[model samples]
Target: MKPVFFLREALRALKRNAIPSFAAMATVLVTVLVLGVFIPVVQATTGAANEVRGKVIADVYLKTDAQQKDVDRVERVLKSEPMIKSVEFISKDAAYKTERERNPKAYELLGSNPLPDTFRITPGNPDDIAKIKDALAPEAAGGGRTVIDPAIDEVRNREEDTNKILAVTGVVKITMALLAGLLGVASMLLIANTIRLSLYARRREVEVMKLVGATDWFIRWPFVLEGVIVGLVGGVLAIALLAVVKIAVVDPLAADFALIAAPDTIDFPLLIGLLLVAAVAVSSLGSGLSLRKFLRV
Candidate 1:
């Protein structure tokens, strides 16, 4: 079939079934919107969680005066354990200076530098922080070093709490993604079935065309093109819905949550493009589904 002929026939079919076509598009749009919204929400939550994780300092503080060997040894110990991302050493001067800045009157009260040097040791295994705390704290106290491990106590007590909160949020995101995917598939199936019904209603015309010696391509191209148009329309509508949800529903909630590691908020142009792609997918799925029952063409 000529491309123009297919286009003309597709357009004609659209005009003849405007109501059902629009209904199908609307449902598909809603489904796609759910998926779009779910993605950003999960990203935002994860980002915020990372931000919180950054706030979690080490449990043990090792005071080192630029001793590369000591710092390197501590780093190796932490890394070899498991799940420890990194360990860093903070010089005595830096820690003292930071303390002074934090307490404006510390200099006047102490008369001189009272802060000790420390190693900010992050644990490789979150669970190991406790074992490390038990093993290391007594050593710090026994070593008679002026430095202290304040964070060790905090980590020993609060690691489980932090892990629980993070785990809950992660699960929420996963659940949302799964739900969105299911809905999207449901929407596609519904659209395909709708198209199938429309094809069945016009079955007599298709059979007559086949009997009159019309080529399969000539008889089928128009319907396939019609499905594409519907898919495109649905995709466009889905994007529009996503825009409104992002701006009005998501932005306010995500403002404080979109920290490092979070999925950036949806941009309008990008969403439109995604929607267009989704539209094509919907159209193709619906076309293929409908064709299975109307292959006589």
Candidate 2:
């Protein structure tokens, strides 16, 4: 009939099946809580991984006797490459000064600057490091020594260190993505099971309505509304709990730890909105699907 009738029916069903309703609500709360905590953690972790990837760079050492024109030519070539993000040139004097600052005693014994002019190259993607290096100095056709420009002394990209960083960050990203997917599937199944229980508890009522020529939609509305109410209540409760945790634990810890206070995290209001929407949508879908089998009667 009217929407009010369905709403009333849903409320009555909840009151009649208090224990089942509570269980279903509790399930939703737990699922939402896990997701709420997970969203920001994933963001923070991904941000950190990207920061590490940014450090993967290639250093091109120019010949000690190379002229300014040679250095300019090398810079132009590097800048024209599509995969290269940036190229920074450090003169021999600057390099020597920096080294001397790090260790005054080591440089004091030297009569002149020993370091060569260098080009620091950052790639658009960390994985393209080897490609960039190979492009600069390709190996001979028969696997002989790498060929290079006459004005370049060497190209050192620290392949081993880059590989280690890339491997760790790649694994971290893949693991986080897989874990998020598993959690999503688990949440949906848990909600479905809880909704199924509620449906089983009122199977006879559904069958009676079906037998009395009531339309399926007419019988389904109340149960669907019931699910929505449960989900809304559960999501609200979860948000409250999360707020308490954030204020009581996270805020204090963040104040002391720069890592915890990273700017890459999702905004709290946006995260809360997402969790609430996810809860309602999942609950409604679970209830509707669980009610389908009973409607066939």
Candidate 3:
């Protein structure tokens, strides 16, 4: 049978089962929102942790009384090293001011600046950090310079801690994805069952059509279309609810976590593609389920 006749019959079926159709749509919408919020939190925290690990830098402190020319000489040599990515000089005065700004109460009690001049050096990798430490130990050991091996070790320890956090988040992310997938499949089954029941209720009329010189295909198409229509509505509602969650909940968290990859959640193109795919899949499943009662096979 052609689609025009089936389309009219499908609309009539939907009008008759409006309450069940609405229930299925509402369930699908709630599922989308749960998955939407789950995705971004996993993305942002993971992104921020990686950014920190990829940008580790070590500080090399010097005696407060160290000469400017001596500091410049060391800076020039460090810059020439192959493994070093960058070297920045931090003067004692600058360090003092930074501390004061960071902790005003402690700064208020201080009589004089306590921080030493330092070099913040970023190396190419973990191995490069080891090489720089070996090369600098001899010079930092002598008469007046305030060696910074302790401070560099602290930075390495912090990187280790970041790695631990990443591992835990990875586990949590896996757990959430599995949970969401199960929930999605359950929602699909619920929608299919809803359409199946509606089809069963109208089986008498469908049998009459089949008996009155109607072909099997002609009698079956309308029930399948009815299922597809319900499925499509559920898919549309799911997409709309996902958009609301992204704007209302994810956007505000993203603002405060800008350093953590501001656009952490699903992008528009991906979200749209997912929505269309979900709609088609839902409709296909619903059609298959609902048509079982109408078709002899």
Candidate 4:
């Protein structure tokens, strides 16, 4: 049979069973929308976590009365450690200046500069944070009271906060994946049912074709084409809706949430392509599965 014949038959079947066709398409639309929206958000969240994780560093605060020699000694020790990637010393005055710049009005209430001299230690990796901290702390590595670095009054690391963020991102990804799977299955079943109903409605036509010696493959092509059309249309609709949401809702909010450093990570073109491919696959599979019973003749 010619391609035109299959297209004509598929179009006629779609028109004859308008309700089921619409239902099937709607199911696909909802499934694709849910998948499209969350997948990008999850990706952006993960990217932000990675960016922060790369910059993870330890802050070593010094005693108020600590002098230049103390700073140099701590700096030398930090440089010697294999876990340490880089160290930058910040004087009390410089720290105070940064605070003032960050919140100009808040510092007006303070009588004197209370910020301490500090050394910011960037670790080779976030996992190496604990080792680097203990090495530079006042306590010796063996737990004896011997001070390893006298100038180090306290040590601070944001490893816990980073871990929590990563954990939450992981949970979000897993939840989205499960939800996408459920919706995908649901869409497939709905499409299959729609195709089954359409075929059943035209049982008489199929019987006539079988009597005239029409092969099963010839009988199946139109239904498969119909399924492909339904899927492609649904995917297109979902893509349009997602595009609107991205432009009106997501794009506008990205700037406002820039402080978290998570925006601009979602690749729109790639996402749309994947959604279209998934839609076609699910729809076609559903149609093929439903056609088995009707093809027995």
Candidate 5:
């Protein structure tokens, strides 16, 4: 059959069953709208969580009398570790200058620069902080304090603070992921049910066509086209609504909130395209599958 014939039949069916058609379209619209909003929210939240994780770092303080060679060796070892992302060395002079700038009166009483040279260690993953600290200062054979390198004075990673941040961020990410999965499933079911209802209303027509020797493809094309039409209209409407929200709400707030302005979030045009494709694909599949039982005649 010609494409025009299938499209005309689909249009005629939609007009004949306007209420069901409208209901299916409305279902698609709501699903698409929810998805459109949820995508950006998830991205922003994840980005914020990552920023917090990045703050979890380890500070390795060297002995005040440590030589340049010892400092170089420590830096080399840190850099060799697979779990360490970066190692930054700060001289005692630099540390003293920074502290004095923050509180000049506190430093005036000191006879000499008391701060030790420090190595700031950032881990590839926040959870690896304890390993990095342990690597630097493991327990001694007699259970006394010991350092992996004699030049190292102490290692601190603020374990309590790191654990808290990791726990909170982990829960947030897991919760968001689970919620997104659940929402996606619900959307699919809702759209599928709406399409099924439309198919149910036209079951008699399907049966009559089958009984009259109409090929399955011949019967399926019109219903699939009808679903495609509904999905296209619904998706376009949803995208327009999202665009208005982005312009009026998100864009205005982007200047004040780093989360909103972050470049890591999904691109708006790409997101819209994905939603449109999803809407059309789901509707057409739902229509085709829903017609299977009726086609058995």
Candidate 6:
């Protein structure tokens, strides 16, 4: 059959079964909406977590009495280490300035600057943070008293912070995957059921066409096209709803939630397009599956 013939027949079927068609479209809308909203959120959260993870650094704080020369020597050695990606030296004055800028109120109660000079070491790999921290540990200078390297006081790896971020990201991903899978299965089953009902309403007509020598594909294309149309429409509606929520709810409250990563991580338009395509594909698949038993006629 020609394309126009298929289109007309699909439209006719849609008109004849408007209620079921609407039901299928509504199901698609809800399922796709759940998918569209959560997927981006999970992507953004993981991206932000990775960004912060990449910044994980081991801070080597120096004693107040340590000599500048010794500190410089330690920094040079740290830079040459294969496991360390980079090392930045922050002087005591700079550290104090940073603390003051970050929390001015806390400094007001103190009489003088108590911050120490430090070397910020970025590890070559996040998993190797502990190794890098151990390698940079201050050496025992002498007797049983065990004094550290002349220039070092303490080393803080921020291990707890890093682990927490990773753990949270992992949980978010697993939860999102489970939710997406459940909704996807529900959507497919609902679409299939609706398609079956629509097809059953016209089973007698299908039998007549089959007896009159109509090919299986020739009889199948219209129903399949009808389903595709329903799915595409539903997808479009879901996307519109998502856009509204983003603008009205998310965008407005974004400033209050500073921890959320930038939205640039995922391309909104591309994501929406993919969702629309998925909706159509699933709808087509559901329609084909539902028509299997009727095709035996």
User: Candidates' TM-scores?
Assistant: 0.69, 0.91, 0.54, 0.61, 0.92, 0.67
Top candidate when judged by lDDT against the true structure: 5
For model 3, state the Cα shift of residue 92 in Å. Answer: 23
Candidate 3 segments exceeding 4 Å error: 39-166, 248-253, 256-259
Q: What is candidate 6's lDDT per residue for 213-272, written digit by digit as tens? A: 999888888888988999999999999998998888886787678645564556778889
Error of 5 at 109 (Å): 1.3
How far residue 210's Cα lies from its native spot in candidate 6, in Å, is: 2.9
Tens-place lDDT digits, model 5, residues 134-243 = 77788678976688888999989888899999999999999999999999999999999999988998899999999999999999999999989999999999999999
Tens digits of lDDT, candidate 1, 1-297:
589988998899788877876776676666667666665565566556555545444544444333556656654655565545566656667877887788868576887665444556655544355555554544454564232232322223356665675566557657766876786677667777777777777788888888899877777788878877877777777777777876887667668676345545556577577767876777766765566555554
Model 4 Cα lDDT, one tens digit per residue, 100-131: 99988889888589899988988887667777
Lowest-lDDT window of 10 residues in candidate 4? Answer: 138-147
Kindly list the per-residue Cα lDDT of model 3 for residues 1-297, writing each as its tens digit: 568878998787678777765665565555555545555555555555445545556667666667777677777777887788888888888988888999988988986898788788877763356556656653444553333333322222234654555466556657666876786677667656665665677778777776787877676677667655655666666667777766897568667775434524567668656765675567656765566667663
- Clashing residue pairs, candidate 5? none
- On residues 31-76, what C-alpha lDDT tens digit does candidate 2 reach at each position? 9999999988887888888889999999999889999999998888
Model 4 C-alpha lDDT versus the unseen true structure: 0.78
lDDT of 1: 0.64
Flag clash pairs in model 3.
none
Give the poorly placed runs of model 6, Cα more than 4 Å off. Answer: 51-55, 60-119, 123-128, 131-156, 200-207, 255-265
Candidate 2 off by > 4 Å: 142-150, 260-263
Runs of candidate 1 with Cα error greater than 4 angstroms are 33-38, 53-57, 63-68, 76-86, 100-117, 121-158, 214-216, 237-263
